[model samples]
Target: MRKLWPVILVLLIAVGLAVVLFPNGHKSLRAEKGPKPAQQSQSRAVAVEVAPAVTAVYQEDLRSVGSLMSDESVQIASEISGRIESFRFSEGQTVSAGDELVKLDDALARAELVDAQARFELARANLERARTLSKSGHVTERAQDEAKAAFETARAAVELANVRLAKHVIKAPFDGIVGLRNASVGAYVSIGTPIVNLEKIDVLKIDFKLPEAALTQIFPGQSVTVEVDAIPGRTFEAEIYAINPMVDVNGRALHVRARMANPDLILRPGLFARVTVKGRETRNVVMVPESAIVPRAGESVVYTIQGGKAVETKVTLGRRSAGMVQILSGLEPNTTVVVAGQLKLSNGSEVEIVQTQSPSALEKS
Candidate 1:
């Protein structure tokens, strides 16, 4: 038992010495055998095609798909409840402002006006008598004042009756083309009930969405070419009239409005149109090949060659034209970017520029 105790004591002393000398001995051994650093893992040079991100004149046109609208569109409706007595304008007929389009039963409105006129005449006579008597000190000033107020009230009633009678005859609010008729003769309709559609189509408007960034790039009066699908092979000219002040939060875009003239009465509202805005003024911009852009996690990234290594950079992309894309930000001009073999490359990866090429030259090829 004593011999065993000496062996156990010696083992315990050795174990205590090891713990005090190497507190992380196992960790050190594991570290020595662990995977290599990221750089060493990608030490082999990946063969890739390279292109210089050069400064280029960017004047690409802004194109959008949109719909045409009427310069003025309205759902023609009645202002008062009445039975439709007659339709003055035929279906699909052109109408001018103040032209009677529909007539309702105005018998009640005329009777009301006549009654109001009678009362108005009586009130005027009473006011005149009161004023004469007041001047002679026969009637009190209070009676004269009451008579004057009564006269004014009757006058207002007459005006009100005229307004009501006018409502019985519906007129065109503007020069426009009338759409299909909804009500027949003697069909009763209430206020705001749609009778037909009136559209000012001599001049047309267009509505489309554009990137919010375009707010500063575009302006009113910019010329654009519009191609309507219904009318093939014909390009109509249009002009930007306005831009919406508010931004669409969900789409992050701006609503743009434009106007187009239809002198021959050819172009119309409610037609699908493809609008191509004229190119902007020439300005220097950083451009790279589209192949350089790598999408990562819903973001655009590019590989810039620095010291023969791929340095991953996030870039804000802009207009793409002729196989090249504009780098709005996060990249500088004259920087070398990888155009090919990007799929096998990672950040800090060693690369060999197997072929140096220009994006524009390659696109032409």
Candidate 2:
């Protein structure tokens, strides 16, 4: 009876263990069979902004910074020394060619001219009398020759006096605007004294330099665009009228000069200018927004939507202008490209175009 008591005690312990482990085994089986909570699916399509690669006329231009200059600029200086009797032009006045600007005291010059004229007349009368006497053999040939020589000398002296009198008046060399007067009336001025500055501002000259390699693209009569910092947001059209034949030895650059019409005289010399020389026109070029380009591993790339997925494409680049880039190759006309949201994209990325921008809008970006 004691051994049977031990067997009963062992049986009770086994049952207790079974009771404790049954629920855990059932829970594990249910967990394995239960439909796993559907994995949270990732959003498939990436929202992106797109723009079309369009065909447009693209111009290759040479750009440079330079300065504005007058078509003709000169410092007005006195040619002869004298006291200014009167000023015919006011400061900052416009004058025509040959218009008198200053008048010096001509009293002495006038008197000298009168004396020369009187002497010339006396010499002429004497020469006539000497010729008449010589024809009748009343005067010797040598005496007649002396009289002729004296008359000729007096005539030359009279012409010299006239030139001296004209020098007393200073005239404008060309039609131009005069700067502020440097001398006042009654102020004595020496030769080469600065009177004023004269500038022909009806047309302005733009001087700039470009690399000597660009010489083949530049020529006379080519169109140029000029922008001034003083007058922002306005571009002036000009033409290349002159190009320096020799390249600057120090800079290895070719100097170029362009001309722009300024009938209103708004543009002045010495202003800073930005110049663009239009070189060649390429028609039907594939152009894309600058934002579309992604430089990777030393190559430029853009994403184009193909089969509703982003297809990474490698593109050859050309001239860039105004927030736009010229795609020399690797893109077709009218192809749509992702301009925005490129950071989240990969090859064959599903794209949902949230917005489409116009070609002109892309250009202005």
Candidate 3:
């Protein structure tokens, strides 16, 4: 038992020494083996496409859809009911102001006018005779007064007859192109019956609605560019001629009207149009490709390559146009930004730029 005690004491001392000196010894040895090869390989450069931010002349423009109209449009109609005697103008013909378009039956109107003229002449003679008799005091004052009143009434009747006769002829109110004639020769048309449609297409009008927030940027005489689907690849320049004072409550938009010259008369009314209202031009603004922007949570960010590593940067954005975005802040001109392969990127990540493209070229892509 004494010998066993000595041996046990020795074993206890050795075990305490091992526990104190080798605590976590196996874990320490495993850690010394280093990280996995896969983890080490992940540190290698990630292939990405890069582009430099550029300074450009950025013209802030408001875009909206609208429709085209004529400078002058009206539905030609008759003011008086009558049977059409003849049509002086053909369908779709260009007519000038005061050109006779339709002539209604004037036989009854002319007969009435003739009768009125005869009565008017007789009244004029009687009035002259009455004036002479009144001057000589041969007729009573009451008789002269009655003759004057009768003469005035007859003169008014003649004027009324002339008006009725003029109603038989319908003339072009303005120089315009007439649409298909609705009334033909000998067709009876009542008052307000549509005869045809007249549209002055030499100058075209465009109407568009924009959000009320853009009201400060738009005004009369501001120039705008109009693109029509009917006329592909062609853009027309127009000047804003009028703006509605009231805003549409339903849409919160302002109504605007612009005029463009259509000397060739190729543009017709009711065509769909895309309107772009040009605002102030900002010079030396930093612009980046839209692909470079990474929206994170509620903020926008861009990955820029600095010192061979990707540095995530928070950016303030401005107006976006044509697949490019204006960077209001957080980016400098000529700074290279990662445009592609940003999904595999993080802060301080090594990046290998496989392609470097111009901002404009990136926009096209």
What are the lDDT scores of the predictions, listed in order?
A: 0.90, 0.91, 0.91
- Write model 2 residue lDDT over 117-226, tens digit each, in one string: 99999999999999999999999999999999999999999999999999999989999999998888899999999888888999999999999999889999999999
Query: Alpha-carbon error at 181 in model 2, in Å?
Result: 1.3
Sorting all predicted structures by lDDT, with the top scorer first, yields 3, 2, 1
lDDT of 2 at 205: 90
| TM-score of candidate 3 on Cα atoms, chains taken together | 0.85
- Clashing pairs in model 1? none
> On a 0 to 1 TM-score scale, where does candidate 1 land against the true structure?
0.65
Best by TM-score: 3
| Candidate 2: residue 261 lDDT (0-100) | 98
Error of 1 at 112 (Å): 1.2
Model 1 RMSD, rounded to 1 decimal: 14.2
Candidate 3 lDDT over 1-365, as tens digits, reads: 88799899999999999989999998889998877887766658899999999888988898898998888988888899999998888888999999998899999999999999999899889888988988888988888888889899999999999999999998999999999987778899999999899999999999999999998999999999999999899999999989999999999999999999999998999999999999888999998989899999999999999888999999999988887899999999999999999989999899988999976685465
Residue 295 accuracy (lDDT) in model 2: 93
Residue by residue across 1-365, what tens digits does model 1's lDDT show? 87799899999999999999999999999998987888565758899998888887877788899988889999989989999999998898999999999999999999999999999999999999998998889999999999999999999999999999999998999999999988899899999999999999999899998888777777898998999999998999999989989999999998999998998888777789999887675677888989999999999999989898999999999988888898999998888899999999999988988999965685473
Native-vs-model 3 lDDT? Answer: 0.91
State every prediction's TM-score relative to the real structure: 0.65, 0.77, 0.85
